[model samples]
Target: MDGPGHGDAALSAPTLTAREAGLVGCRQCTRVCEAADERCPRCGARLSSRDPGALQRVWAWWLAGALLFIPANTYPMLITSTVGRASEATIVGGVIELLHYGSYGVAGIVFFASVMIPVGKFVAIAYLAILVQRGHRTKPKHLLHLFEFVEWIGRWSMIDVFVVAILVALVQFDLIATINPGIAAVCFALSVVFTMLSALSFDSRAIWDRIKTLSND
Candidate 1:
């Protein structure tokens, strides 16, 4: 009566993947197609069971983003000129200055958007890449969720850059007071763009494929 239908036994069974079922999914449209199909009918996208170059591209972009991020933190993000005197502020410096002025809420927002989020994304993407490379011993579903989270938050990391651009455009007052974006702005923007490319280049199906390979062994 309580044989194969047992709770733990059933739960421990490996999840079946589309690849195992001889299916390929369109990355753009999420349409399931026969593995033999060259393209997805719904989206006209090339169909592949797994992206052969996904990890390579992910690491390449991730490295470019990480390298640029170092200079982004070290250099000034915004240069402010007031009464012909110039003062530069980096990302962390801006947050500290905000807090110094008792703008606690704004400071927190800036810190989260500029500091914590980017670091979190870097760590998350690297972890996902490592997991996939190591054959994904962890739950593929969880890995996929983490990848999705990284992708979702990737765009928001540019909040600081956007803020700098807005301030630079609106605060120009020639000699009295002017705000200009600094070198760090360019670095940070490029870093954000590269990291976004890293996330986009990742193939979530690779996670499932690795999981299936492990289960078969």
Candidate 2:
């Protein structure tokens, strides 16, 4: 007649945030110390629940990454020289060529990794930055999860750069065929790096701070 855990349902475990508990966690070593403490004893890093310039740094890097991303997709990513002929391929063109060659799986992987992932990261990072900056209290937990996902996926976005690097290094044939990385490769690499820095500069604790503020109000 009773639901699962019905006997313990009335007993609630209240959640307490570090700020609510008068604690500050070191960003470097995650050492918990009293909020009154000026620095973390374990790592000696300055402790703060929220970074005042977090959004500014995040926006700066985000803008740089977004700007570089335009040229990265527009220009050729690779230049292949075969005998007397030379061909250049942009990111989309490269994927299309792979598909034309019946390498569907490889093409899909390239398209997803090179195009979709980067764009998605840009959108996700922008969304998180805006939400935190605006101090939106709606679904703070979900926003925190989104921030973590963006951070986790940041490194993987460099797959295209890695592939280009490997090809530029391994595919060398004097008179037969040779592959060289194009300008877009540099732009794309820089875009990935900037976006990664943007994600790293973001302070996820800001999301919870907004939530706590709203709760207290």
The number of the candidate with the highest lDDT is 1
**Which portions of model 2 miss their true places by more than 4 Å?**
1-14, 36-38
lDDT (CA) for every model shown? Answer: 0.89, 0.87
Model 1 clash count equals: 0
Candidate 2: deviation at residue 35, Å?
3.6
List runs of model 1 lying over 4 Å from the truth. Answer: 1-16
Q: Number of the top candidate by TM-score?
A: 1
lDDT of 2 by residue, 87-174 (tens): 9999999999999999999999889888888899999998887777666768876887888888988778788889889998998988
How many pairs of residues in model 2 come into backbone collision?
0
- Separately for all candidates shown, the number of backbone clashes (residues 3 or more apart, or on different chains) is 0, 0
lDDT of 1 by residue, 41-154 (tens): 998988878778889999999999999999999999999999979999999999999999999999999999888988999999999998888886787668878888899998
